[model samples]
Target: MSESAASYKQLKEEFVSGLSGGPVGEIVAVTAVLPIAALVWCLLQKRHAFFKPYTALGNVVDYLLNVGAALLAITLYANSAVLLMVLLLVPALFVLGVPPSTGARRKKPKLPPAAKSYNSNDSKDDTGSSSSSRDFDVLSTKPFLTFFRGSMMVLTCLSILAVDFRIFPRRFAKVETWGTSLMDVGVGAFVYSAGLVAARPVLKERAAHAGGRRAMAATLPRRLAQACRHSLPLLVLGVVRLLSVKGLDYAEHVTEYGVHWNFFFTLALLPPFVAIFQSALKIIPSYAALALILGVTYQVVLESTDLKAYILTAPRVDLFSRNREGICSFVGYLAIFLAGQDTGMYVLPRKINPRSGSSNATQRTTLLMTMAIWCSIWSALYFLTTDYKYGAGLSVSRRLANLPYILAVAALGSLQLFTYCLIETLCFPEFYSAADPKAEKEAYNVATSRVLRAYNRNGLAIFLLANVLTGLVNMTVPTLDASPLASMAILVAYSAVLTGVAVTLDAFDMNIKLS
Candidate 1:
């Protein structure tokens, strides 16, 4: 007899449910390996010359050492406790560019301003991923952003395939509900990342044609059209994904997003919603306040009414009920997305302030202080709202994406992003202080691994590829009973294929732009 969707759901339920996650600090530490290797490899990029005249081989080596290290960090975690601890410590210490005993960090001298020629070329594509922007007041290189995004994507890529295997730890899987886990954190992380990059960019390649002044007022129709332009592709992709899953009779955990809903649809909706509601969302105090308000209101409805019951236990009988989780949880995800934008607003250097004559050191310090404040506030909120603290003793549910989940995401996201920023500051102090956009970008380009940058740039393609490969593997191989050694071997090979594609794409100067 063929396995039904209900059977598939039950199998996965037996696999992932009824478990609280492992220690946050442990997962956080293992994750730190990716950035640590990336940033350090960037600083020591010249060492890759061992493969001179055969640069492709160098890319292979870089992938094995840097990207590959992240895989090993997961599969071999039990065996490398000391190394993981050390990887965790380097970021904690060097982020400050000072010793535990040091009073203050020594500042580096600033580079002269770039000849105004690079303004047009600095900001590239709609993503406004380039740190050197003509639209923003501040412009600095941000490999840290790339590193963080890549790390999360890689973790996601590896875990999706690995989870089917016995060697994959259940504690890291998505909990049934009301608890934290690695996969749960990833859901919020993606929402946060989307908002982080979609912060309206203050970016326009052709702003110069419009009197060379950034338009303070973009019309509502234009905003919606542009948001549609970006988000519609994802919607199309969502439809494609749905068709493929149903056509293949793929086993899907319907509760994840619901019968017809997936993350693509959820993610696609965000840009337009954000476009329509940004002004209202950016209410008093900060963007995050609106996020908190939305989450709290949603939680109140869930708690006060039968909405939570309807969400968790309702039959997938109708269209709305089929996608209830995606529809209802949207409010919480939007809150996370908005909070991410709020973070990007601060972390991204929008415009250079000419009046203050501020050095990058001073700017970094100020940003660090702001991050510290955010961290303290959110961490306290999380503790206070949890069952362990003085409040209602709520549990974090990825399924519901409750207020507690948002709070946890904010607290952890702040700390993680802060660490990434610190890595960039320490890895490339010249980047912050340098005035030449083209030159600083070149220097940054040289220091960071092209392989990582490839994954970072065309992340959507990588994700698509990983998903297809995961399905293919599951169809062909019996992953559920694979031994640890067999699982590790398969995982490493899978990761290598992903990395090789990234390297090849980087070599060809191709960016898939699907993202």
Candidate 2:
């Protein structure tokens, strides 16, 4: 690298270095806005039928709720985080802390009157026969999970480049080595999401084959090939990104993942690993337990030995040393992935009948179990992150993807899921009462939250587009020196483009799945 380029890289590195981050409560507040805003937006759309009167207004609302609010995850959030937290506290205390409200306002297909997803039964020893299994269903359309995942992706898209500009809050950027930031959602939540979507299929496979070694042997080659096919796209993207950054002398941060390592490569490596051990439940039984074992064992390695030191300080003479951070952090991400997969299984049915009280009972049983586990996770988080010894206060490292980081991801991800479920249950009653779940799901998707569906459909494609746009803007415009007004204008326009494309693609049923 040239001297001036080297100096510029140094300046960029220093700017993002050593940040301890703001209160975790504030980060949670930023997270709170996503589900709250999405639920509110869905409600408003259901009630107003805004698109019927004015399509443009509906589009704007989608932008604000999906992409615009996601931008807040990285910027403008630290300012009024307390207010958001206060708003979140009221509902959280009522929803998770106390008995779930039994009163659900019933509405028709237009609004699907209520969710009542978390209500406890009058039967003290109720068998798990309840509609609460599909907790965030919003019933057929899945607005909650779709919107939730889209927001995370958009926020990541915005923050990856937003950190380069002066207008973006430095505190929200990825932390130097440890602590938390809004951007710290990073690959943990993301890979967790990937796992969430993959969970049902894995379960189906396990059930069909009965975890037989012979069955796995028959499917293993095809699974590995399919995984490789998916991985190829990501590998190509990683190589292209690396070559472009080096060839163009782009402004880059080497320490972020270390020399020659980028997020794409980190992603590229995961699929094959997943394919190899996708049947792990046969041996470990519970994905949650499996994830905990790997994460705690990795944490032990980091704390008891010199691996962490080697990752942080080793010379980049060989490929392994050059990308130590990404290599080591992969274990953490995989654990988070399995944990997410466990959650995916939560909302699905173990039997064929959607309305069979017996099946519903099993699903509800799973939901309650999930909640129990969720509480234990939070308790573990509190103890592990406490400041006494290797607590999160001192040991949490986004770079390392340490034990504390996995716990935080699991806690926060579950919190978001539960919040959405609570909203769907309270607001949409037709879902559980509907005779045909397949038809109702389609109706809800079309009538209420098509934008979110579109986003969910073309997630990877949109992320790639955002990456391209960010690079173009950085190359053509002086991000670090732009006026605040100009920067805001640019960011809004960027978000608008992303949301617009997603909407348009959904309108046409165009879906792209690139790693």
Candidate 3:
């Protein structure tokens, strides 16, 4: 056979071989099993009574169910089963259920004049509080959903990096992989979702200060200063990693972040950039629009120039060419972060009313409906953008962080939040009221909350630990050559160690907060 025919034959073999079980199968199998286990546990807990959605047991079941559904959807997509992935929508909606509302609203009794006067005075005092006091308030407010998200982010990062996961075909050509791949979505989602949480406080504090020209000017410098301070450690680490054996082979570098350009550098710089823009424009940039513009510009630039060629085959790895994706993708990631900030604006508030028994139910239902709508819209847009001629169809590209990829990450993150919200509202409604010390204490005592809080408290540390462990594993073990079972065993062991460390640190109040 001719060389061209041989090449084609090899490509066909690769495509066929790539369809086998890997991390995607493992995750899907686990997702399918966990819900069933949770259901069984719930049933055992409610031996004589019907399962109560508002009870702790019910909350556990709900959490498991939602997680399983989301995982199943993601895994299916990763495996190139787009139809099965789409079919998950119906069940996700059914599980999400309808929002329940009480037709009657409770009337608040009027306070005595003296009491009213005291409340007014308290409000004035709060308004006049120092910035430190406000910061403390922000620190104290640890929503369950936020904790859940942080934990999930850590878990997803581990799953992608620490194991032999099936990578979907890069494009929609003759290769047989479906929708957006998990590897592509993981890091972007992690960064963007975390950014959303981080931005809330900055925006809130700015609004509180009645952000004007002077405030904006002051804020920019402070944000820049903070960015520099945060970037220092990441820079040091990046340099160290690059100088070390890990950087010897360019192909081994998962993200060009530390080795070529630092993602932390991008992340650190983005806040100040956003702050400056917001200050100048006197409006927050629409994240969706920004993402669209950035993604399109990136595609245009790639198609219009030899930039792609330079990126792939530069004479030597340099700051610019080696880190082209790292640098260009910053805008896309920034847009994602901003979009996350918008999401945080909607999700961070505590909407459930403890006085209403059905409030939790209502909140869960609303989240489900909202996530479903957004997911569908994004999915449709993703398919619509497919350039069949070029064999590119919204495949998740961490390097590009394109529109479809952003939407998919946002949708997945939203679904994860919905699951956490269901658990928090149904199982521990009072947990939402951070202002109530008694409720907060009670909520913290719960087993689930304790584990989540542990992860939340030391999220950064846990992430760093995973990175270190991954490096160690790579150096010590033949990861690529290991059997699937062996790889998974290592992953499980790594995660367990990380979790144990996190929980122990939490117990000792030893959180490693880089920022």
The estimated TM-scores of all candidates read: 0.84, 0.82, 0.66
On TM-score, the candidate that comes out on top is 1
Tens digit of lDDT per residue, candidate 2, span 1-515?
Answer: 77866776667667777777666777787778777766656455444344433367767766776667667656666577556545544644444344322322122234333333445662222565444534333223354567667767776777777887777777777887877777786557788788888676665565556535344443667878888888899999999989988887777666678788888887887778877766675798777788888888998899899998998888999988988888889898888887887777655433323445554445544565565567477547756665677565545677998888887788878777777666664554344433334445644563445566676788888878988898889778867778877877888888878877888888777778786
lDDT of 1 by residue, 1-515 (tens): 25554575457546755667766666666666766666555444332222223366666767765667777776667446458657655754454463322211122223335434354456665875654534333434477777777777777788888777767677777777667877788778878877777664533322333446565566668778888888888999899999998887666777778899998888888878887776674455767887888888998999999999999998888899999998888888999998888887777653323346566577677877887888888888888788554777888888899999888888877877778777666655555544455666655564456766777777888988998899898767767667889999899999889988976787798989773
**Model 1, residue pairs in steric clash:** 136-350, 136-351, 137-350, 137-351, 137-352, 138-351, 138-352
Estimate the overall C-alpha local distance difference test score of candidate 1.
Answer: 0.72
Q: In terms of TM-score, which candidate is stronger, 1 or 3? A: 1
Model 3 residue runs over 4 Å out of place are 1-118, 121-144, 164-179, 210-218, 246-259, 262-268, 280-285, 303-318, 350-377, 387-396, 433-435, 444-448
Q: In order, what lDDT does every prediction score?
A: 0.72, 0.69, 0.49
Which runs in model 2 stand beyond 4 Å of their true positions?
1-10, 51-54, 84-141, 206-219, 350-369, 375-379, 389-394, 446-448
Estimate the TM-score for candidate 2. 0.82
Worst 10 residues of 1 by lDDT: 100-109
Candidate 2 — what's its lDDT?
A: 0.69
How does candidate 3 score on lDDT? 0.49
Best-to-worst order by TM-score is 1, 2, 3
